[model samples]
Target: MARAFNAKVRQREFYPGNLVLRKVLHIALDFRGKFANKYDGPFVVREVFSGEAIILSDMDGTENALPVNADALKKYYP
Candidate 1:
């Protein structure tokens, strides 16, 4: 099972200063609706870890202490 999963997974890379959209963390905010935005930011990538982790910051420049997995990130072209 693990091999199958690994075979299908592709590595995604992000660089410092690159913009990306992060998956919304649902721990806080009250539920909005089915159509609510499920992702946030065009956040700045602060750093990339050797594995599937990264540090990110919002547009206003606040750095997040938590390291997010690359699976939760999507590249922002603009």
Candidate 2:
């Protein structure tokens, strides 16, 4: 079962200066109302860690307080 799950996993990467969106949790959506977005920001990548963690910056150019797990991020296509 573990092998089957691992096989379905795909690898992704991000680099500093790339734009990405962080996943918004369902609980957060409830407070923001029904139309709230499922993802937040084309937040900038301030740093990347071992290909598994990333530091993101707000759009206004301030770094976030914590490193986000790569699994919580997705590349912003636009």
lDDT: worst 10-residue window of model 1: 27-36
Candidate with top lDDT is 1
Q: For residues 1-78, what per-residue lDDT tens digits would candidate 1 score against the true structure?
A: 999999998777799999999988777665676667888988999999888789999999999999999999999988
Model 1 scores what on Cα lDDT?
A: 0.90
Task: For each candidate, give its TM-score against the true structure.
Answer: 0.75, 0.76
Model 2 steric clash total: 0
Q: All models: lDDT?
A: 0.90, 0.89
Model 2 C-alpha lDDT per residue in residues 1-78, reported as the tens digit of each score: 999999998879798999999998786337558777889998999988884889999989999989999988899979
